[model samples]
Target: MWLTGRSIALIAAAAVSLALAALVGIPALLYVTGLCAGLVAVAVVLAVLARPRLVLTRTVTPAIVEPDEPVEVVLDVGVVSGVPVVAGHWRDRLPSTVLGTATGTVPVTGEPRARVEYVVTGRRRGSHELGPFSVSVGDAFGLVQRSLVAGGRDRFIVLPRRHSLDVRVGPAGATDGATRLHPTSGLGQDDVIARPYLPGDALKRWHWKATAHHGEPMVRQEESELRPTVLVVLDADPRVHDHAGFEWSVSAAASVVAHYGGRGFDVDLATGAQQVSLESGHGLQDALVVLALAEPDSSPLIIPARERTTFVMTGSLDSTSAARLLQAVPSRDTIAFVARGTSEDAHGALAAAGWHVVVRDSNEDLEAAWAAATGVPA
Candidate 1:
């Protein structure tokens, strides 16, 4: 539905020739106008008749990736029944949420099928739709051009990055009761079961009720252990941090989730917007996706992080935001990973709330910051 440069030049030439024929009384000028006009008309007719039916399929390799991770995209192109498409240019629409070069020269051989490819990296930690791919086609004389659009859309996702907070953490204070209990049989001497007593068994192991009911002495045998639970909370207030700082907080929370979950701690993740109970350290993907799609919220950080061990990951805080953060928690063991630019009031408030506050820059080494938070001074 647009004009090409060549068509514009031809139209101009035809108009000039007709004008010259009228003023200069030259029959040759009229012939030139007729030729130019006739050629333009034929080009238009060909453009209208020569329509193409196109099918495009696209794929993103390594369906799961983190921000700035390069992903290769392959577009399979096929032409069904239509006018013979001449060799032209093809370009895929890459949205603002992604970064890549999506244009290439498309050589239309006699074959009906072809392939185009490009690489795109997701700009942020979320899912974004890719395209409604289109290509340009034109007549043999290159006087008229038309566009062919492929149907449908494709979705791509970018996950939050996880850092190895290389610190051996001490007991994360957690509650005793749990819905999903992992059996710790033979690991410790707690939660013992009564069994038939044997000779040489200690008197302390004897169960009086079993002895009376079974007509034989029954002794206690120990079995089963319970895994501790930890709650990882992310602060989503936009006023507390700039863009980079907020992103860093997200990555830090992801690291904490992975670290404890792998070591057998039941983990739960929370943002001001949503909370996901990752009981028994299962549903790790569910936690990550939440972080990926999370946005800064105006809601106060007053969600209950009642677990014995609670982690608060957030950016630099002023006095006001620090007060807001203090509202949700004063858990038995509280840890806060905060930005380096934090005000003194913020630090004092967290300490008053009994949190072991750790401060560092968004770009600082994650391991170093974690070590400082959990280990003895180096």
Candidate 2:
């Protein structure tokens, strides 16, 4: 129930008389009540007739951004004929990942059109929805309020940043006849020869004829090849800490893949999300598009094992998982490019599994780690 000015005035007058009965005396209080009630009634009637109907709309620019990038949002409001709307409150709905303050009430000016603008910075990568902004308008007297919800929701896609690395990992295992090559082309093969049975030599590659002649087991020591297949595996676990670091790792991995892909090597990408295999002619643009569209995943790796597989992970790995990954392709060379600050247990497990582990602190270290893993000159 809403009160008119006359009703409010009459109530005020009665309250004043009760107060006067304890102060100026009941007679004076009663005399003043009648006069005040008549005036207040007029004010209430005027207030009720002046409230206005309002409509609000909102728009956001470039509804997508990279992590840490900013976006602009604008709100427009219109008033329909009714009681004049003096002031109102508006609340903007934003994604939880977005950081900062967002809610305001602005006084309406002589003109009904009002524009409210603000900037939002995204702290993580993923798709976010914003909207269904709300508004509540009221008359100057604060007698009546009409609230409304307006505007459709908008979506924003936050992409990971581009990262670069220094390491290049080579394909796993050695092939007969041809030298053991680095996964990427252009780098020349090593020219080392095998000597009489070394403690570390694998028995499978042993030359029995040489062992018979020399009276000792001897394994062929051929130079590493120059045309190695490079596979980059990305861990998309959202539970991992340091979102920025993970994104950077992805960028660095992409850079390496692009570099090797351009050099005519067969490059394959494995992520928690999906697998992408590109033959020699695919360019960086295709790779970038994939990176931009990639989102964090908690799924297990489903890609089949190959001769050379490089696992690029941004978080720590457990022993069982590491063992399973290694078992998937026993003959293939495995390189685990992990974040620099992983736990000792993870490191120990990977090392025990015979994976060439390269610890990187930033995306910048990726290329260097790869080069080191594959024994390629930087």
Highest-scoring model, lDDT: 1
Model 1: per-residue Cα lDDT over 1-378, one tens digit each: 456898888889999999998998897998889888898898777767767677888987867787788989898887653465554688888779888998887766667778889898998788877778888777777888778888677877788888865434532332222322334446565676554432123456567886678675565555454445677889998887788888888888888888767644667787885888776568887888888888888776555545456788888898888887777664645678899889998999888776788897878767777777656343
Cα TM-score per model = 0.74, 0.56
Clashing residue pairs in all predictions, respectively, total 3, 30
Please name the candidate that would achieve the greatest TM-score relative to the true structure.
1
Q: What is the lDDT of residue 94 in candidate 2?
A: 82
Q: lDDT (CA) for every model shown?
A: 0.74, 0.60
Model 2 has an lDDT value of: 0.60
By how many angstroms RMSD does model 1 differ from the true structure? 9.6
Query: In candidate 1, residue 191 scores what lDDT?
Result: 70
